[model samples]
Each structure stands twice: as structure tokens, then as C-alpha cells.
Target chain A: MATKLARRRSKAAAFGVFNPNHVVGGRVAGLIVAFWTAIALLLWIASPWKTLPTPPEVIHALHDLWWNDGLGPELFTTLKLIFHATLITTVLALGLAYLTVVPAMRPLVQAASKLRFLGITGLVFPLTLLTGGGYALKVALLTFGMASFFVTSMAETVLEIPRSEFDHMRVLGASELLIVWEVVVRGTLDRALEVLRQNVAIGWSMITMVEGISRAEGGIGALILNENKHFRLEDVYALLLVILLVGLGIDALVGLLRAVLCPHARLGKVRR
Target chain B: MIPGASVGEVVLDVKEVGLTLEEHLILDGVTFQVKDRIREGITTGQVVALLGPSGVGKTRLLRIIAGLDAPDSGTVRGLQGEELPAGTVGVVFQDYPLLRHRTVESNLLLAGSIGGLSAARSEARTQELLKTFGMEDRAGFYPGQLSGGQKQRVAIAQQLVVPRRFLLLDEPFSGLDPAALEDVSKLICEVANLDEFNTVMIVTHDIRAAMAVSDTLYMLGRASKNGKHVPGAKIVGEYDLVDRGLAWQKGIMERPDFVALEHELRGLFRTL
Candidate 1:
């Protein structure tokens, strides 16, 4: 009976792509990833379109961009801008979201969240006039672009919190301010991290456009625009790849931070 | 064998409490009182069960008592004989909500601090409660890592960390297996015996489980008069197991009288 049970367990773990509630082992999962990669490579090699840059060309362009074109500094500038914008967005968005607990602040928060629907192109002129159109403009544009999304997600996180949690805090003799601190601020910190992680991607995607508005401080966005204008398709593709890799790295870092700071966020159903 | 139990002055009084949501009467004229239970000169606490079928306003009534929700009519009086103030009563929700971002220890510590414990005292109380709940080893574990039963234990312990006189549990025995059910029953009894002023009101549909752990049982359902069903739920039945020689008895389920009462309550529950 023991051997039969073991055999059943092993079989169940071996292949479970189509099975609900069945998780494949690490080896099986790795194999599945490799299979998809192989198929993607074959498709890339066989594509009829020749205008797309080949892998070898893209790699050579990457080497040139790194060695001669100051891609390193440009990338650094973009990252720095992202860091500042994210810091400001975090403060502003969180303040607005947390203040929603007060009846008077809800309409203002709702207005801020609704600003996400407004296009950045229309607001760029006004923002440039407001910030005098320099590095300040870049940072302002990025912050403006990101804060609405951050507020939207963070506000939803606060709203979705079960009423019972607030009640639980009240029962613990928590005052209204303490309840906000415990249930809203501290309770949603991990979720805030997750929301930040998601919005950082949006920041990355928008940086190039924001940088175009004020080209005094050169960033990857400015570099991409320069390359694209010159019809340097290979360099453009290489810069795109660089952005992808950097975005993935930032994502991994945020995930690591969440794991360390909120280790409980990752845990799910440990079978005794 | 009887544990020398005696009832004292009422600590909680609900008089003519009524609620209406969207033109539908949920609870009307729901009145009851929980008195201090003294045994051998120690306040061993009293466990009261609020039993009813689903959607019978059991949860709503519990909320009103905890001051989380306000009833349209009537008032809930606390030990001071005034309107029950927010933070005066502790509540354990049916889903056993805990801070998912925090470890069990951090969650308890926060509760203690909210309960007005000093930092040093909060830490000591957290450690003690962790040990009491058999969660000392899992103190670093997150709520998501623990099973349903473990989360329930943490939820209960979170309340006790602050020395609350009253705790309300909604559906404490809903989804437990038999062994877990037995464990929770014992845990409820142990908590009740921890303090003389401590009172637990458990709202559940599980008649047998509630009967096993509670000294007082109240049923909520609509009354009938002159062949017409009443519009709202109220305290339709009340039983004092202490007077019936059934309170605080181990292996009470095996008693013939206990089985008979279970059958009787089961019949009464179907009517609700």
C-alpha cells in the first residue's frame, strides 16, 4: 500500500500542465520553459520578414552602444530619474490613499485617481510651464504620470480591505488614528510594495516620452529617440533589450525586498 | 464536577436592538444580557452561543454589540451601563482576519500595543500568548503559511493579548474537521477559564459544536403570531446549560441529555 501510494504521488507530480490544482515538480517546470524557448527560437529564425534585425546584428549593436555611445550613463540617468519620481509618487499617492479614511479627503483622492485617464501629451505643456521645462520637467512629468496609477492601485487596496479588519483593530482598543496606522498604513505596506512594483513598469514605459519633453539631461529615453530618429533600427532594438533587462532586474529587486520585509506575503498553505 | 459556577451582575445588555438594510428588517427587538460568571471566587468567564441558520442577522447583531455597526433602534450597554463604545469589545471574524503582511508575533504585538500595553509589556504578552496558543514555534510564521485552524488560533490569541473582557467569535467551528473541532472547543473553554470577567459570544450555525463549548445558548429567528411570520429576527430561544447540569462538563456530548438537546436544537434551527 505504501509503495502504491508513493507511485501515485510521483506520477501526479511528474506532468500536470492540464490538471487543476496539480503543481509540476521543478524539473518538469524547467523542461516546459525550455520547450517554449525552443519553439520561440525556431519561429524567430524562420520568419519571412527580413526587416527585423537578426540576433547577431542586435548583439553587435548592443556592444557598440555600450562601448561608444555612453549607454551606461544614459541608463544610469534614467534609473536615477525613476528613483526620484517613485519616491515622490510613493509619498503623494500614499498620503492621498490613507487620507481617504477621512470623509473630507475622499473626493480629492477620487479626483486624483481619475487623473490617470488624462493623457500626458496634453498635460506636458502645462507641466513644462509649471516646472520651467528642464530636469524638473522630466521629474515632474514622470511623477505626474505615475502618481495617479499609484493612487488608484493603493486606494483600491485600502478599499478592498475587509471591514472586519478595522473592526478587529477597534476591538483591540485601537483609536481611529491607530486603526488607520495599523489597518491602513502598516496593513497595506506589502500590498503597496506590490503596487509600486507594478507601477514601476509604467514608469519605465513612460520615461522615454517624458525625457523627450526636456532633453537637457540625457537618459535612455533620449537615446532611444535619437537612435530612432536616425533610423538606427539595430541600436533601437538593442536599447529596447537593455530596457527589458533593466526592468526585469528592478522587478526582481522589488520582489526580493518584499520577501525580506514581508516574508509572510509569500507563504501559502504549508501542509503539516 | 459542577465547577461551582454563579452568575453575577450583567456586563453586557442589549435592549430592543433593531436594524434595517435597504428596506428589509434584519434584526428587531433583539434583547439579551451577559452577566459575569464567578466560580470559586475567580471570574472563570462565560461562553454564550448565538445560534441560527445562515443570513439570520447573527453577524450583524455581533457587529452592533462590538460597536462596529450601529442599529437603527435600541442600544447596547457595556459594563458602564452607557452606550457600548467602539473598542470596548473584541471580535473574531468568521474568516479569521489577521495581518497577512505580519508574522504571528508581530500581529500579536501590534494588538497588545493597541490594547495600550507598553512596548516591553506588549512583547512579554505576545510571547506569553504565543506560548499559550501553542504557536511559539510558529511565531515567525505568516498568516498565509498557517492552516485555517492555526489562523483561527492566532485570531483568538490576538484578542487575548490585550486582556479583553469580552470577545465575539463569528462561526468559530464552520469548516473544521472533527479533531480540529474538538481542539477549538477545548480552546474556547480554556480561554473562558482564563479570566473571571472574560465573556465569549460565539455566533454559529453549528448547534452541536456551540452546545459543547457554551454555557448559555440563544437562538435568533423570526417569531410567529396569529399564523403570520414576524418581519425580523430576534432572540427566539434562550437556554442556560448551567441550570440544566450540562455546562463545563467534559465528554458532555456522550450524555443522553446532551444528545437529546442537540436533536431539539437541530429541529429548532431548521425553523429559522
Candidate 2:
């Protein structure tokens, strides 16, 4: 008991911000959340909508999109791409991270991966040069171009794990497999998930861009491009609204997973 | 001729060990042997405080012994019977670094799992450690939800996920206050005594804490990585506090000896 008290006192002394007497009211948390919502509402209100459709019109448009026939199928197509593309990215990332962190393979793999990163720079502009067009090519390019991004981000997260954590496990007599599964995989999951979160916006955008270039049957990018090419400005904005809603939905899903998989993560909980 | 050369038994031995960080000589010519088990028969225990001036390589020596670093040269030998490599031993550091993402139960599971603890036995050990640490209530909470003392307790408990013949700790009680330090020290004693009768070597400059719990003690001197004594870096003195008078033991913290020792250690750094 004395020890517990002393620990509390010492920690209290170290961080001066915490007021022992401060009671966090449930209402204050709600109010702070409302303040953010009010700001978003104002942004939506002020987004040059007078020259186009207002926020209410956009909401009504969304209602029609949801309630109208065939739109649900269009939404599902984009969701499917997000799901498959994320899975591919994660798998490639995990494999690359394994190669990067596994000690026996670390040096050779790191050296090779570094070279791979250099090689990967070719993806940005070179793809526009080679295999210039076609739906198949666009999908292939998106997958290939983004594949290295997945590997780099995941491997980097795995590499950044503290060495001390590994040493502690090594001394405990943990085997390489157990260390990988329990220590490395478990420890790095949240970080890799964060990498996933960071790339979500970019990943979707890239996939949509490729989809449009390839003349893919579904996805917001294709839909927006087709409408804009036809000079259907109202449809273009309407498609833009659809894309924003879907992006928000995807963001919300990842956020929920983040809360479940790594609740203690102090950062990335709030998104812009 | 070495007076202690004929010491009958040695379970863990460090011979002519040294380490350096940047240009700073962290540990110099540190030598000690822990003969925790003689002929597989556990012997009476001794708690030795590794004390020195603050800049000495006290903690570095402990880390080298823990296999956290490769000593510039020399050797560390742990139990010959165990499967550990020629120079491997279990280690615990100053910061507990318990996994904040996992439950107390899962944390122990990770420790046991990564330590290559038998899957069944390790899981069982997790349950047992939970009971032993009186952390059954905390078994479900993440590290973020735990208090500092509890986190350290869990960290210490995590160390016991698997037991070996020797344990190396690097100033495990530094940031903790007197009472918490005592509790942790007592807990360390109990855990070490219960496990394979693991010989424990703790590195600390805390004179009072050194007296609090230890079977024997060594004072480190700061020397180059090659273990040569520098003009300013020397242990200067050593002591065996176990047999000291009760008055000295009880009053050591408030006494001149500890204060003078503390000042002497600080003097080594300031003069250097």
C-alpha cells in the first residue's frame, strides 16, 4: 500500500498537467465532440455550394442514390475494390516486413529492399510511358505500383520496433517462431494498421485513378471521369459527393478496426 | 595469485568484461562470478549491490551480461547445463516496456510465447504469474489502464514468464520511490528464490537500495571498452552490507556513508 502510494506520488510529480482532483465529466466530452461537428457543418455550409447544390441538396442526392435502383450495386463495386486492394497490400507488406525483420534475412533483405525502393521510383511517371492504356493495364499498374508502397510502409514499421522489446523476449527463452508471432507480429500489427490507415486515402485515390484510366465498369473515379467527359457538370459534382461519402465510410470502418485492434494507440484516433 | 581464484563453484561468470558508448568508457574491468548452484545443488543466496560513481559502467556491465550488448571483449558464462548459448542469460531493464496493447493475461502469454515457453505450459504460467503477482483483477486491462507501480509489477511478472538459472536486472528500481523500490526488491527476492534458484545480479548506484535487498555486491569502475582504468573512473571502494550492524542497515539512507558515497559517485563524473 505504501509502495502504491509512493508510485502514484512520483508519477504525479513527473507530469504536472494531471490534476488529481479533476473529474472528467461525461458532458464535457460530448460538448467537445459537438464543437468539431459544428465546424464540419460550417465547412460544408461554406464549400461554395451557392454556385452549385447546397449541403441539403447533396444530402437529398445521397438519399436518392441510396433509395434509387442500381446505385447500391455501384457502391458495392467500389467497396469490393477497397477490400481486395487492402488485403493485397497487407499481405505484401507482411511478407516484406518478415524479410526485413527476420535476423537471418535482415541484412540481405534490407539491402535488397532498399534497392527495391530505388527500383520502385519508376512506377510514378514510367507507367504513364509504358503500357500506356487499357483497363487491365491500369488495374495491373495500380496493384504493382502500390505493392511496393505496401511493402515499404509495413517493413519500415516492423523495423522501427524497439530492440529492447525483442531482447526481453530472447532472454525469456522464446523461440524465433514464437517471438515472431507473439512479439513481432502482435507488437507491429497496430503500427502496420496505422500504415494502412495513412495509405487509405491515397490508396483509394490511386485505385480510382487507375479505374478511370482503364475504363473500369465501376468505382467513383471512373464514374466522375465519364460524367465530366460528357460535360455533365451536375453529375460530376453528384459523383464527387458519392466519392466523399464512400471515403468517409471507409475511413469510419478502419477507425472502428483501429479502436478494436489497438485501443491504446494514443495517436491517429482523431482524423482530419 | 588471486585470493578468490579458487572459489569452489561458479554458475555464471564474467571475466575481464568491458564496454564503451561513443567515446565514453561505460564499464571497465568488471569481474564477478555467481555460483548459484554448486553441483546442481542450490546454495545459500547472496545479494551483491553493484555500486560505483554515477558515470561508471555499472548498468553497461549488467547489459553485457544480459546479452543486450557484445562487450568489447571478455566473456560471460551462464549455466552450463541449460541450452542457452555459451554467454546468454535472462534480462530485465529499467523501463518495464510492458505491451500497452495487450491484457495482463495476454502480456504474460506473449512473454511466455516469445520466450519459447511450452505453449501449454506457458499459458499455464501466465495464469500462475497472474495469481502470483496478485494481478488477477488487472488480467483484462491494457497497460495504458495500469498505474506505474502496477505496470512495473506486470513488467516484473512478465520476466518470470519463464525461469532460468540466472537473472540480470539493470537498475530496475531507479525511478521508483523508496516504498515501491522496497516492494519490487522484496518481490524480486521472492521470485528469484522460487525460480531455478536463479542467481540475480542487479546494477544500481542507489546505496540505500543496494542495502535493501541483495546477496552480494560489486562496485564498477569506468574504463575504456578494453577495460583499462581511466584517471577519474574507478570504483574507489567496495562493501559487504549483509553483515553490517542493524543500526547501519536501518539508518543507512539517513547516514553519512550513503550521502558521501552518492557525492563521491557524482564527483567522478563532474571531475571527468
Candidate 2 C-alpha lDDT tens digits along B10-125 = 67667766666786766565566665522234333444567665656666666666766787866777556332351246666777676666788888887776666788999899
- lDDT values for all models: 0.88, 0.65
Q: Poorest 10 consecutive residues of model 2 chain A by lDDT?
A: A112-121
The number of the candidate with the highest TM-score is: 1
Give me the displacement of residue B272 in model 1, in angstroms. 3.5
Give the residue spans of candidate 2 off by over 4 A: A1-50, A55-69, A102-135, A264-272, B1-8, B19-28, B35-44, B78-88, B110-124, B195-197, B223-237, B243-272
| Tens-place lDDT digits, model 2, residues A69-146 | 356777677667666766776676577677765578776546534544454335545665665645435544555655
Instruction: Tell me the docking grade of candidate 1.
Output: medium
C-alpha TM-score for every candidate: 0.89, 0.76
Span of ten consecutive residues with least summed lDDT in model 1 chain B: B1-10
